[model samples]
Target: MMSLYLLNTKNTYTVAALMEIAKELGKEDWDFSQNPCDGNPNWVTPTGNLSQSKNVVICTCAHNDSCHVVNITLMRQDLTGVLPPSLAKLPSIKVINLAFNYLNGTIPNEWASTKLEFISLSGNRLSGSIPTFLSNITTLGYLSLENNLFSGKVPAELGQLKNLYLL
Candidate 1:
């Protein structure tokens, strides 16, 4: 398969290394970044730690509708560290592609409040029980937590997500 690169806004990494980051993130990051490249021109510059870029890859949505179109996909960037709870504040986010990475720790309980439609967080080192608050995120359609360190029984409250099509 061909590889894709997600450049740091500084554009420091070689395309080859960028492609490697995309691959480690699950190949989905490349796809999301590509969709908006045609018309909307979606781009994400690494804000912090180049070595752990995915952890800081925040979605900067435009205020006006004209520039508000973003697919918000960055699945396999090989991101590590705990997901920042601040991420739940992005109300404009639609799709969050964080599939393959070294992400660890608990899924933020505050994420239950976001307007996320698709959330992919498989293949990480996450632990602790799935947050019960996530059941309140009615907009979530696709949720993936496969291949993680999460233990205990799956919460029955998760079935509360009526709009959930995949889990």
Candidate 2:
């Protein structure tokens, strides 16, 4: 697997460009196909006094032309500010696991376009209604929005995701 430091260098450490580097990285052979934090106990980010800006690591490595499957996981970090809406532009995005952070904002409507299989946004300060557009993604399997300050009823449109196993 490519190291985070390496990814930073290759992409000039910008959030938008990192996705492209990640896609290229995926072209190479690697043992870990899923998010790196999946099997480790320390995968969870620690709370309290974490770096304010040192939060998320979003890697988008979806290949152009092909149906890219970008894998993203932001475990334990001190991420702040609104999530960049441009993230939804990555067509190959599949898994998005972001648990235990200080993200405060609304879930972007654009996220509905990605045919995501796993999406976890637990333990954050996110508010507002869960976008009904999420139902547009039919491939969603795992979804979690617990422990957030989100108000409003869960959109019934999400019921259309037949593959969802977790909420």
Candidate with top lDDT is 1
Off by over 4 Å in 2: 1-69
lDDT (10s digit) by residue, model 1, range 1-167: 64343334433232343344344333333443342323322345444435433422333433332222224444556667566465454445567766777888888876777888888888889999988888888888999999999999888888988999998
Which pairs in model 2 have colliding backbones? 22-61, 23-61, 45-76
What is candidate 1's CA lDDT for residue 116?
82
Q: How would you encode candidate 2's per-residue C-alpha lDDT over 49-156 as one tens digit per residue?
A: 355422223343434312223665655554565554655665667777667777778887767777778888898888988888888889999889999998889988
Q: Candidate 1: TM-score?
A: 0.61
The regions of model 1 sitting more than 4 angstroms off are 1-70
TM-score of predicted structure 2: 0.62
Residue-level lDDT for 65 in candidate 1: 20
lDDT of residue 68 for candidate 1: 25
True lDDT of residue 162, candidate 2:
88
Model 1's alpha-carbon lDDT is 0.60
The C-alpha local distance difference test score for the whole of candidate 2 amounts to 0.59
